[model samples]
Target: MQNIWSIFKRELRAYFDSPIAYVVITVFLLFTGWYFTTYFFLAGQADLRVILGIIPFAFLIITPAITMRLISEERKTGTMELLVTMPIHDSSIIVGKYLAAVALLIAMILPTLVYGITVAFLGDMDYGPAIGGYLGFLFIGAAYLAIGTLGSSLTENQVVAFIISLLIMAAFYLMDKILIFIPNSMVSIVEYLAIVYHFQNISRGVIDTRDLVYYLTLISLALFLATRAMAARRKR
Candidate 1:
């Protein structure tokens, strides 16, 4: 636990100590703010549906950027070997780094609460869906971070890690959308695999056990793969 905490602080500090966190957060807020303001004014809707709808798209880009360097940079700089030789467990290192990425994700999301608050002042706002939307965002973002960590663990090149994570995420994001091309027999399975499908289910103010299970399963699977990758590196 102590080792995990230490690594978590180190990883989180690594993010803010450089310009990466600032640049990523600024770009993310700017993108989401622009869309939220435009949609709120034009649609005059009291709901956060527009912001919620656009965030997954934003995450596809921003998440990879946030996690691209977590392990890959360590490998590139030859620090990964040193770290693995320490008494610390690989799972601890992975969880700590994963938590740091999640922290950044939450930071990116916190500012968007202003949108909901603004809507409340402008008119009647339903807090239920708003709460659900944010919760759904956290779940989806955590899952993506885990997947990104797995990508980072696979290669020493940050660009390659970014591309790998982005491609995998894009495939999952497009899964439900491409159901028409899938056979009827496989439609249910494909839709179930779609990240957006589970996200949508939670964003509707209805948190189903199935959606929760799906996200937990994805996060666990990705992190497990990342740990395995780390173990393989340690062996070589």
Candidate 2:
């Protein structure tokens, strides 16, 4: 427990120690802010549905950028060996790093709350969907971050990591569209496996257990794969 916390603190600090954190956060917030303002004015409604809808697409890019260096940089610079030699489980290290990524993501998300507040004051805003949207974003981001972590584990070069993560994310993002070519029987199965399907389900203010289960399962599987990759490094 303490080991994990120590790793978490180190990972979090590493983020701020570099300019990447600042750049990513600034770009994300600025882009989202601009889009939110545009959509708000165009719709002339207190509803944040448009803004919330676009957040996932923003994350499709932002998440890979944020997570690309999580483990890849360590491996590239030979620090991974030092970290692995420490008296901690590989799971702890991975979880700690994952937590740090989530923390950064939360920071990226926190500023958006002002949108909700502003909408509430301006007109009749349904807070329920807004809350659901935030939750859905977190879940989807978690799944995506886990995939990014896997990509980071697979390569030492950060650019390669970013590309791998981005490609995988893009595939998942377009999973529904690709389902059209599948057999009728398999279409339902493919749709069920698609991240966007479950994401949309939760975004509609419906807290369905199946949707939560889908994300949790993906998060677990991705983290497990990352941990396995880390463990494999010890053997080599």
Candidate 3:
């Protein structure tokens, strides 16, 4: 626990000490804010649906960039060996790094709350879906960060990590969209595997156990893979 906290603080501090956090947050806000404001006025809707709709797509870009250097940079700089040789467990290292990324994800999402507040002031806001959208975004973002961490653990180059993470995330993000091409027998399985399907379900303000399970399962599996990757490097 102590080791994890130390690593978490180190990683989080590293983000703020450099321009990475600032640049990523600025880019994310600009992308989501532009779409949300544009659609909110054009549709004359007082709801936050526009922002909710844009966030997941924005994450496809933002998450990879944020996580690209987590473990990959450590390896590239030859610090991964030093980290693994320490008394701390690999899982602790992964969890600490994962939490730092999650913190940044939260930071990126926090400013967007202003969009909801603005919509509320304009007209009656459906708090149920608004609340659900934020909650769902957190879940989806955590899952993507975990996947990105796993990708980072696989390569020494940050660019390769970014592309690897992006491709895997894109596949999951596009799964439900491609159901028409899938046979009827496999459609259910494919849709069930789609990350956005569960996210959309949660965004409707209904929190189903199945959706919770899906997200938890994805996060756990990805982190477990990252831990294994770290373990493999330790063995090597």
Question: What's the count of clashing pairs in each model shown?
Answer: 0, 0, 0
Over 197-226, each residue of candidate 3 has an lDDT whose tens digit, in order, gives 998988999999999999999999999999
List model 1 lDDT by residue over 85-133, tens digit each: 8999999999999999999999889988899999889877878888889
Relative to the true structure, how large is the alpha-carbon lDDT of every model?
0.93, 0.88, 0.93
Task: Give the lowest summed-lDDT range of ten residues in model 3.
Answer: 38-47
Which stretches in model 1 have alpha-carbon errors above 4 Å?
Answer: none
lDDT digits (tens) for residues 1-236 of candidate 2: 89889988998998899987898889988988888788678766666887777888999999989899999889889998899888889999898999899888988898888888988999778877888889998999999999999889888889999999999888888888788799999998888888888888888889999999999999899999999997886688
RMSD of each: 1.0, 1.3, 1.0
lDDT leaderboard ranking: 1, 3, 2
Q: Estimate each model's TM-score.
A: 0.97, 0.96, 0.97
- List ranges where model 3 is wrong by over 4 Å: none
Whole-model alpha-carbon lDDT for candidate 3: 0.93
Candidate 3 collision pairs:
none
Clashing pairs in 1: none
Backbone-clash count (model 1): 0
